[model samples]
Target: MDLVLLAIVVGIGVGIVVGALGAGGGILAVPVLVFLLGMPVHSATASSLVIVLITALASLPHHARRKNVDWRNGLVFAGVSVVGAVVGSRLSALVPSQLLLTLFGVMLVAVAVAMLRRALRTRAEERAEAEQALAEDSAAHDPAAHDPAGQEDAEPVATHDDPVLDQPGPDMVDGADGIRHHHGEPEVPLSPAAPAAPRLPLVIGAATLTGFLTGFFGVGGGFIVVPMLVIALGLAMRRASGTSLLVMVVATAASLLARVGTEVQVDWVTTLIFAAGSAVGGMLGGPLSAKARPSTLTLAFSALLGGVAAVTLVQTLLG
Candidate 1:
């Protein structure tokens, strides 16, 4: 296939993936530029940052309108991450490409494993909830299910809709992508509660690490940021995803600028064409993501990570 054609095709896919999955999208870009487009790894990484920045910007509005973004928190994370990105970009010049590839392969495997584990856990939790609901229904219908004292009036068991249980569950709609609605399930509304004290440190640490990776590898840092938001900060998955794009815009811009005239060199013609395709595809991915089941998406992402890891490992080993 013609190289320009290939870049355009791959760019669209990368943008959609970013819109759908956030951070991992940049991983695909680096490999495509290196192996398919015949660019050196360093140059590919720098170019990938530029593409990632544009894709994030393109996808931002979709999530923003859905109220998925936490601008204050996003800015905090982005601020710290930008510092790390600058440091990482400078260090990238000294690292051997082979070593970088090996490290990236390892990182991919780790992400795949983490994704698969989370998927399995989510499935198990859903199953448990179903079983509990069934048991409650059975108990409610049983003649002897009343209070042992046989009081004339008894308190009813609280249901999923109870205020106490109103906390977001795994199956809760993360409609940040603007597509997957379940029988009119409402979007998980954002809480204005302050993050816990412990969460502040965790967010700082994770954001810093995410930024460093973005600069070093020319990735958008969404994969790491999204999960951290979900796990550490208690943000809904959709909110985490939307907020991730906001953070990426800043971090990637910093990383790209750091590489100017230093690490990233490209044929502006091919780069521009690829970026345009990516921007268009990014706009479409938000709606598609809303339709996808979280479990299904997680499993698919896991598989993709594993496949990429295998390919990277093999290439790095052979080279």
Candidate 2:
């Protein structure tokens, strides 16, 4: 009974991470099951898949309600990733348990370092934007700063050659229904000029890699998917996070199905209890994440991953 309670508590924590960040469910779950619940590595990895699948599915509705999901793109990415997931699951059976744990530790460290670098970059960008805003404000006050040529009385010339000015205004967006909508307004038919297409090849390559990682490590692959959606598909961080959940649901399901015939045994009782707790946590985290700053959350999560990785490495190598 006590162990079941502990599992619930741990699952909630893992689910909160997955729900809020759109990743980390399996990364955290595998270690917790092995070290805390005394489950074997193989069993833990398989069980982690269940926890991730449940959490992602539970959290997805909240993001969808906020219009954060891009259904068409997410489905395409998931479909391509299924092949990679099957291949990776087959390869995972060949690797030894100790080696897999060690590799998982190394991957955690790499992800932590990458996240730290991204946080630092975001901070620098924010600082640069603030400085630029200050400079613009100062120039507005001192007309001479912006009008060095001293042509204040001359009529300003409108230049159509500057493509930046021709772009859609901030509030305009192409909705899923093939209409353009102004912020908080009714949708209208889109203009004949359409947005540029996303990079299909890059997206496919990233999805395949994400699937391989999910199957091999029992991770949700949201860390990779979120970044791919943001950089390759031109989604904002919040939208990318929501969209990544949709991808994770498919990726985890594919990986789990591939393991069906394997000899590895899963403790269904513990797995279901953990999943139940995660489902509740997912409900809370989705709303909380929508209110929090992405940079702050990313830095905190990276630190947590670093600590977990250190502990896992020490225990695996020395004990």
Candidate 3:
């Protein structure tokens, strides 16, 4: 196959993956450019940076429209990571390429393990929640269940004179946020609590590490960002993915700027073609991501990470 065509195909696949999961997709571009298109690693890295930035920007709109992008948090994370990106860029030359690739492989494996464990924990939590809800529902309905007043907590009987009373009088309904609501009582709107004070430090630390990886590898650190947002920030998977892309756009752009006037070489024509394909794929993937089940997405993302890690490990060891 023609090299340009091959690159475009690879780019499309990477873009789709990125759009869906928010990270690790663009990392494949470097290997494809280096191994398949036969570009040197440095050139491939530079070109991949361009593609990563373009692809992230392309898919961002879809996420924005869906209200999945957390702009405040994303910007904060990106802003902090920029400092780390600059530092990582400066240190990139000091590291050997083989060692860098090996480290990248290790990082991918670690992320995969973390994702798998999270998925299992989430599943167990959901199961426990379901059982608890069922028990509550049963107790609410059963006449044998007594309240603290020692009277059976039976459903209230409606009087013909008060037609509204015939309808199920307000009993306690379990809410998703672990709050229970009494039907007859005025519902207290439990407003969203202020952002947790403790999360700022966690965000800063994660973003700094992510920025370092982004600059050192010439790849977006979505893999790191997505999980951090989900695990630490309490964002759902789709929101985390969207926010990760937003951060990637910032970090990758900064990294690319750092390379300006450097000795890096790029094949602009191939890069453009690949980027075009990525843009198209990204558009398609965003909607699909929002529709996907979180557990399924997490498992699939973990598998992909594991696959990439294995490939990188073998290549690094063999070469």
Model 2 CA lDDT for position 78: 90
| Candidate 3 root-mean-square deviation in Å | 8.7
- In the range 33-127, model 3's lDDT, one tens digit per residue, is 76677776677777888888999999999988876788987898899999888777767656767777787678778888987886676566556
Q: What lDDT does the true structure give each of the candidates? A: 0.76, 0.81, 0.74
lDDT of 3 at 226: 81
Please state the error at residue 92 of candidate 2 in Å: 1.1
lDDT string for model 1 (105-161, tens) is 898888899989977876676666678889978988888877677656654332332
lDDT score for candidate 2 against the true structure: 0.81
Rank by lDDT, highest first. 2, 1, 3
- How does model 2 score by TM-score? 0.84
State the lDDT of candidate 2 residue by residue for 102-139, as single tens digits.
99999999999988887777666556656766886887
Best by lDDT: 2
TM-score of 3: 0.79
Candidate scoring better on TM-score of 1 and 3: 1
Candidate 1, residue 192: lDDT: 51
**How many angstroms is residue 90 displaced in model 1 relative to the true structure, after the best TM-score fit?**
0.4
Task: Give residue 74's lDDT in candidate 1 (0 to 100).
Answer: 84
Better of 1 and 2 by lDDT: 2
TM-score of each: 0.82, 0.84, 0.79
Per-residue lDDT value at 115 in model 3:
76
Q: Once model 3 is optimally superposed onto the true structure by TM-score, how far is the C-alpha of residue 130 displaced, in angstroms?
A: 4.5
